[model samples]
Target: GFCSQSWTGLIAQLCSGISIVCWLCALTPQIYLNWRSGNTESLSLSFILIWLSGDICNLLGCFLTNQLPFQKFLGIYFCTFDSMLCFQLFYYRWWVKRRDSQLLRSMGFSDTSYHHHLAPSSSSPDGQPQAGTALLAANYNNPTAPDFFEGPAASGANDAFSLLDPSSASSDSPIIGRIIAWVCCGFYITSRLPQILKNHRRRSVEGLSLSMFIFALNGNLFYFSSIMLQSFVSPPGLLLASLPYIIGSVGTVLQDFTVFSQWFVFRR
Candidate 1:
């Protein structure tokens, strides 16, 4: 009865009803991979990109709805997860590229394929990796299958959530509350606009490889659509919810176009 305060309050109440146990446990596969692999070679960057995009909308939603807790929840959730995924991917890419560069210099191997890490299920006696080459690790020694599905949690400091209709603070002042909310949301989502802009720019998706585009184009469309329907369709709601998704879709399309163009041109 008390939970039906508003859509934001209701959704927050519903979400908060669940235990964090289920939430964290859902991430076991990913955490396990990151721990064992020490790399993120198989993890799709677009997964996090779309996730971050949703977080952008969530940040805006939390800001516009005056729901500080949910907004902060989304912020912390996205940042922690995105940062870790980014870290893993960054190192993996850097390591591979650097290693390959070194190899080119030291030896004569110039292949830049994923085969280095993905050596398939079997091996040969000639000190060569087998075919299929679909595995995520550089070898079985460091598997990256779990890297593709990461999950990060909120820190302990945020565990103590705010109680509704608190008696301690004033029940009258919206000024400071609004300011804090705006400032907090602003600090959170500002970092993501660049990628959105880059996609919006018709620039080369070269830095964004084809594998990433394929993975994200499919996965993120689902994620983006889910987030879109999850929120209402108001001014702040629309801006916070719809705009980033539109940007994401457009970006994905543009990235696809770029990739397709290259494919067509190269084919000819």
Candidate 2:
């Protein structure tokens, strides 16, 4: 109904588009600031993971619905902006690594805060030990455990899968839209979740949010399942949605054991 514009179809779409564009521009700073700051201290992993997950679903829906008729100028615009969001994710991850490295170095610690690395959890050099690390530590702690060590054990299952959504892959969904949706939403969510969960459980506010994580996790998974169930899709979309969940679930589970975190002045 809303999309079926009559008196001002172009006007409505353009207006809504403008609003979205402005919102995207505003969010660019959040990532830019994170990069500048060197950590997602203020941001929460679960929240962002959920946020990214929701973003993916929303983005997919956006691409599918919006780009259907207008794939030329508008299509290109949507693709470009969505791609920028993906860039933001990688950029954010890069920012995390860079700043985390510098900070860890400053503190006389040789630790990398990604999923691959695993170390025991005794204490930290300075402030509270990141609950994210602790959350991740649970899995990595046991030498027998499979390498699922990232942040807090929200889901505990690091799903490294991204099955494409058949609904989006159809002739109806242009290639550009599908591509943008997967790349941006997938990269952004997958990279951020473990870290957010990691911090949430670890009690580290240095890089990332608990509220954001809490709300986002719920919103994202709900949105994903909603879309999936509505159409009864295949493994692709299901897998795409599951990985971040695994990450978030672990975080939630870890939170059961980890302590609380206090909001700081200038975090991610």
Clashes in predicted model 2: 38
Error of 1 at 67 (Å): 2.1
The digit string of per-residue lDDT tens for model 1 on 154-248 reads 11101111111143134432333334333333322332234334333422222233443343334334333433433331223333323323343
TM-score of 1: 0.36
Badly placed stretches (over 4 Å) of model 2 are 1-14, 62-66, 69-268
Runs in model 1 lying further than 4 Å from the true structure: 1-16, 19-21, 24-28, 100-104, 107-268
In order, candidate lDDTs are: 0.35, 0.35
RMSD after Cα superposition, model 2: 14.1
lDDT of 2: 0.35
